[model samples]
Target: MSVLVYTENWDGRFKKLSNELVSYGSKLAEMLNTSTTVLSIGKVDEAELKSLGKYGADKIITVTDEKLATLDNRAYTAVIAQVVEKEKSGIVLLSNNNTGKAIAPRLSVKLKAGIASGITAVPEKTSPFTAAKKVFSGKAFAKFVIKTDIKILTLAQNSYEIVEKTGQAAIESFSPSVSNDLIRTKVINVEKQTGKVLLTDAEIVVSGGRGMKSPDNWGKIEELADLLGGATACSRPVSDEGWRPHEEHTGQTGKIIAPNLYIAFGISGAIQHLAGVSSSKFIVAVNTDKDAPIFEAADYGIVGDALQVLPKFVDAVKELKSL
Candidate 1:
């Protein structure tokens, strides 16, 4: 049996998590004493696909269908399921991102494989294939054992480290049995925020909340994020109040992120908000209320008015950069 990784691409390039998946799958393949293969969709540079060899992929199968360039969940799942069948992959690894969430369940059903989502660690035991994952909105951890012959796992972002190994991946073209009828939706046009880091892929995130008082005060938040070379985020209320876009919102009802560093300004750390960012490696909270719930969760906390403190913090960062 072989270990297969689904490496996702955006705008013809691989994201950081894609490399992590490859490396993770490679390590698992080594443990299983099998080869590791990667399946990529859409238009990606052949050279880049081959470079994944350094991450432990023995082979790279690419489907460069013009129609498959945009994400169509059904079509993508069908393609992946076909690859799993053809490769006889015992373990399938995917990133627990938007695409993985949308297509993983369908692929599991099609392949008749047991599936686990939001897995945070490598399999502890290979015989029963036990994996650790978060449950109850990150409040608890659970270990799952898959009994199926073939297993599918969607890994949480930043949960696994990327390790490089020496190897050259043999690239090949794979033509799956894709039908036009399987494509249920069409993406006519796409609008994306330009020149900013995507929250899911960012290492550092600076978030603001209702305590910012008004959208007019968001300049400092943006400036701080820019100065720190990070992305800007907000709590649910900030987006509801039109102070920030919904894409930037993070909470139980919003996007879940696990960045390396998450900084909060004027946020009270409601449980719902914590559910989204609780997995961050480090948290720094700045709020005027000393007893704010965020402080309990933060590694470092500043009890002061965010408006006055933000400028000073920005100046300090600038001074440090100059030195």
Candidate 2:
């Protein structure tokens, strides 16, 4: 038996979360005394497929079909299910993203496997199996045990540290018996977001809130993000005020992100927003209000005005890079 990792692609390249999942799944495979294989259903670049090796994928099983390019849940699920059946993978791992969230439940139903979503930690080998996960929207943690023949786990985004190994990963191409009728969805238009780092996949994130004073000062936010080699994020009010796009908003009602370093400028850290990024490895808050809730969640807190604090923080980052 082997561990199967579902590799996700965006614009012919594997997403960063996919690499993290591969690393996690590979470690799980080692723990279970098995190998790890990645399943990709699309026209991914061969070079990209091979790059999975560095992140801990033993083999990349790619079904390079035109129909599988755009994610048709039925078509993609059928292909993955076929691979799992043929390979007899004991454990299947998926990244807890929009795509993974959509497909994991369906796959679990079909496989009749015990499914765990929002899993943050590796399963502790007790008697059956216990997976650690966040519950009640990061308010609490729970250990869920699955007592099934086959198990499926969806890892939390940016929760696990990505492990890298030396040597090249092997690539294996397979042809699946794909049916045209299985393809229920068609891509009408693909509107790609133009940026280097997707917020969900970003390692560092610089976020702003209503305390920025006005939307005109967003250039500072963008500058800081650029200086730090990360992406810009905003709070719900900032997005509601049209200061930034809705895609950049991070809150319980918006996009949830758990970046490694989440630097917030002028944010109060409302529970709604904290629910989205409470899992960040390190948080640095730059708010003028000493009583701001953001400071409570921050590993490091600077009780200063955002307008003054942001420029200084940017200058400090630049100075450090020069040295």
Runs off by more than 4 Å, candidate 2: 166-168
Residues 1-323, model 2: lDDT tens digits = 89999977877887668878988998898788889999987778888888898888888898888777788888777888899998899889998899898899889888999898989878887358788887777878888988888888999888787798985778888888899988878889977758667788788999999989999888988998888789989999999989899999998888888888999999999999999889888999999899989999999999998999888888898899983
Best by lDDT: 1
Residue pairs clashing in model 2 are none
Q: Where does model 1 exceed 4 Å of error?
A: none
Model 1, residue 28: displacement in angstroms?
1.1
RMSD of each: 1.2, 1.9
Candidate 2 to native Cα RMSD, angstroms = 1.9
Q: Can you write out model 1's per-residue Cα lDDT over 1-323, one digit (the tens) per residue?
A: 89999978878788789889998999899899999999999888988898899899999999988778788999998899888889999999998998889988988898888998999878999988899888888888888889899999999988788899899999989998889888879788888868998888889899999888999998988898888889999999999988898999998889899999999999999999999999899999999999999999999989998888888989998999993
Question: Model 1: which ten-residue window has the lowest total lDDT?
Answer: 7-16
